[model samples]
Target chain A: MRFFRQVWVVAAKDLRAEFRTKEAINASFAFALVILLMFSFAFDLPVETTREISGGLLWIVFAFAGTLVLNRSFARELPNDCLDALIAAPISGAALFLGKALANYVLVLAVELVSLPVFSIFNNVSVTAQFWELMLVLALGTWGLTVIGTIFSALTVNIRLREVMLPMLTYPILVPALMGAMQLTSALVAGKPIGADNEAWLKMLIGFDVVYTAVSLVLVETVLVG
Target chain B: MINKILYVLGIAALAILVWNIYTIARLPEETRQGEVFKIIFFHVPMAITAMICAAVSLVASVLFLLTRNFKFDALAVAVTEVGLAFLAGNLITGSIWGREIWGIWWAWDARLTSALVCWLLYAGYLMLRRAIEEPTQRATFAAVFSIFAFIDVPIVIFSIKWWRTQHPQPVFWAGGSFPPDWTTHFLWNMLAMALLGAVMMSVRLRQEEAQRELDSLRRMAHAL
Candidate 1:
C-alpha cells in the first residue's frame, strides 16, 4: 500500500509536470517526424529499396527520439532539486524506478503512436497485419530502453557532456534491443509469419528486459543514495 | 623490489616487441596483401591490449559494486582509461592498414564498426563519471555502465565470424586447430601486451586514489 502510494506520487508528479510543459513529448514527436522525413528524401531510391530500409529507418528515428526524451525527462527533474526531494521522501528505490520508467514508457509509446502511421505514409508500407506483434515488440523494446535509460540518466545527470554521452553510453548497450526490434520489424514488414525467427527476437527482447530491469532494481538504491 | 622486477620485465618486453617489428619488416612481400601485412603486428597487439584492459575494468567494476570500496572503482576507471588508449591505437593502426589493403580508409566491416562502438561506449562511461558532482553516485553509475559495456566485448569478437560464415576460415579459429607457428608469436605478444596493460592500469589506479584523497582533504578544508 505504501509502495503504491509512493509510486503514485512520483508518477503523478511527472504527469503533472509533463502536462504543464509538454516540452518532452513535443520535442520527441517533432524530432522523430523530422527523421522520418529526412529518410524519405535522403534515400531517393526506388520503392523497393525504401521498403527494405524503412524498418531500419523507423527504428533509428525511435532510438534518437527516445534518447532525446529520456535525456530531458531526468534533466527536468534534476534542475529544481526535485530529485533530491524525492530522495528525502519515504519512497523505496524500486518504486522510484517504477515510476520513472512508467512515465518514460508512456511518453515513448505516445511518440510511437503518432510516428507509426506517419512512417507508413512516408514509406508506403502497409501496416494492417502484424500490428499486434509490432506493438508487442515496441512495448518490450521500449521497456528495456526505459529501464536502462532511467539508470543512465541518473548516472549521467552530473556529467559535463550529457547529451552526447547519453547516446554514446546507451546505444551500444541498446544494440540487443535495437537488433531484436529491427529483426522483428523487418520480418513483419516483409510479410513473414511471427514464427521461429520472430520468437527468437521476442525471447531476446524479453531476456534483455528482464535482466536489465532486475539489475537496475537491485543497483538503483546504490545509485540513488550515492 | 617490485620496481626493479617490473623494469627488467618491461625492458625484456620492449626488446621482444622491437625484434618482432623488425622481423615483420624483413618478411618477403606477400602475394596477397604485400607491405600492408606488416601492420598486422601493431594492429593485433592493440586490439589484444584493448580487450585485456576492458576485461580488467569489468572485473574491477564488479568488485567495486559488490564491496562499495573506492579502490575498486579507481581500478575500474584506470583500466577503462588504458582501454581507451589502446582502442585508439587500434583504430588508427587499423585505418592505416585498411587504406593500404582495401584501398579505402574506412569500411563498415563488422570488426571495425563493433570496435569503434565499444570504444565510444567506454569513453562515454568515463564522461558520465566526470559530469556527476557526487563521488558515490559517480562510482556506482560508472561501475554499472562498465559492467554493461563489457557485455559487448564477446559479441564484437565474434561478429566477423558470424557475418562471414561462407568466407574462408579466420586464421584465429580455423579447423578447430591452432596454426603452430603463428600461434606461438600471437600468444607471446598477447601475453606481453596484457602485462603492459596491467602495468599501465595499476599506475593510473594509484593516481586516481591520490586524487580522491586530495579531493577529500579539500572538502575537509572547506568545511573547516
Candidate 2:
C-alpha cells in the first residue's frame, strides 16, 4: 500500500513536470522528424525501398531522441536536490525505478504516436491498415527500451561525460531489443502476418525486458547507494 | 619467485608460438587460397583465445554478483581486457586474410559481423566502468552488463551455421568435413594456443590483484 502511494507520487511528479515544460517531448519529436526528412532525401524516393526501410529508420530516430529524454528525466531530478529528497523518501528502490520507467514510457510513446503518421507521409507507406499491430510493437519495444534506459540513465547520471556515455553504454546492450522491434515493424509494413517472425521477436523482447529488469532492480540499490 | 617462474614460462610459450608460425610459413602454398591460408594459424587461435577469455570473465562476473566480492570484479575486468586484445587480433588477421582470399577487406559474413558485435559489446562494458566514479557502482554495473552481453557469444558462434542453412553456405563450411591432413596440426596448434591464453590470463589476474592493493594503499594514505 505504501509502496504504491510512493510510486504514484513519483510518477505524478514526473508527468506534471513534463506536462508543464514539454521540453523533452518537443525536442524528441523535432529530432525524429528531422531524421525522417533526412532519410527521405538520402534514399531515392522509390516507394518500395522507402516502405521497406521506414520501420528501421523510424526506430533509429526514436532511439536517438529517446536518449535525450531519458537523460533529461534524471537530470531534472538532480537539480535543486530533488533526487536527494526522493532517495530519502520511504520508497522501495524497485517502485522508484518502475515509476521513472513508466513516465519515460509514456513520453516515448507520445513521440512515436506523433512521428508515425509523419513517417508514413514522408515515406509514402500506408500504416492505416496495420495500426493496431504497429501500435503493439511500438508499445512493447518502447517499454523494453524505457525499462532498460531508465535504469542505465540513473546508474550513469552521476558520472562525468554522462550525456555521451549513456548512449554508448546503452545502445549496444539494447541491440537485441532493437533488432526484434525492427523485424516486427518491417514485417507489419510489408503486410506479413504476425506469425513466426513476430512470435520470435515478441519472445526475445519479453525475455530481454524480464532479464534486464530483474537484474537492474537487484543492482539499482547498489548503484544508487554507492 | 613467481615473477621468475612466469618469465621462464612466458619465454617457453613465445618459443612455441614462433615455431607454430614457422611451420605455417613452411606449408606448401594452397593451390586455391595461396598465401591467405596462412592467416588461419593466427586468426583462428586469436578467436579461440578471445572466447576462452570471455568465458572466464563470464564466470568471474557471476561469482562477483553472487558474492559481492571486489576481487571477482577485478578478475572480470582483467579477463575482459585480455579478451578485447585477442578480439582485436582476430579482427585484424581476419581482415588481412579476407583481403587476400576474397579480394575484399570485409564481406559482412556472419562470422565477421558477429565478431564485430562482440567487440563492440565488450568495449561498451569497459566504457561503462570508466564512466562511473564510484568503485563499487562501477563494479556492480559492469558485472551486470558483462553477464548480459555474454549472451551474444553463443549466437555469434552458431550464426554462420544457421545462416548457411538458411542462405547459401559459405566456402568455409561447404565441405562440412575437416581436411584430414590439416586436422591434426590445426588441433595441436589450437591446444597450444588455448594453453598460452590461459597462461596470459593468469598472469594478468595476478597483476590486477597487485594494482588493487596499490589502489587501496593510496586511498588509505589519502585518508590519513
Q: Which candidate's lDDT is highest?
A: 2
Question: Clashing residue pairs in candidate 1, if any?
Answer: A158-B131, A158-B132, A159-B131, A159-B132, A160-B131
lDDT of each: 0.79, 0.80
Interface RMSD of 2: 2.3
Every candidate's TM-score, chain A alone? 0.95, 0.96
Which residue runs does candidate 2 get wrong by more than 4 Å? A1-9, A42-44, A195-203, B26-38, B100-103, B109-111, B161-176
lDDT for position A180 in model 1? 74
Best by DockQ: 2
Query: For residues B1-224, could you state the per-residue lDDT of candidate 2 as single tens digits?
Result: 88788777777777787777787778888777777776787777788789978888899988987898988998899889889998999899888877776777887655676678899999999888877766777888788778767877886676665444222233334474436677556766776676677667779889878887898899999999
TM-score between candidate 2 and the true structure: 0.87
User: What does chain B score (TM) in every candidate?
Assistant: 0.87, 0.89
**Position B198, candidate 2: lDDT:** 65
| Quality of model 1 by C-alpha lDDT | 0.79
DockQ of each: 0.47, 0.52
Q: How many angstroms is residue A43 displaced in model 1 relative to the true structure, after the best TM-score fit?
A: 4.4
**What is the TM-score of candidate 1?**
0.85
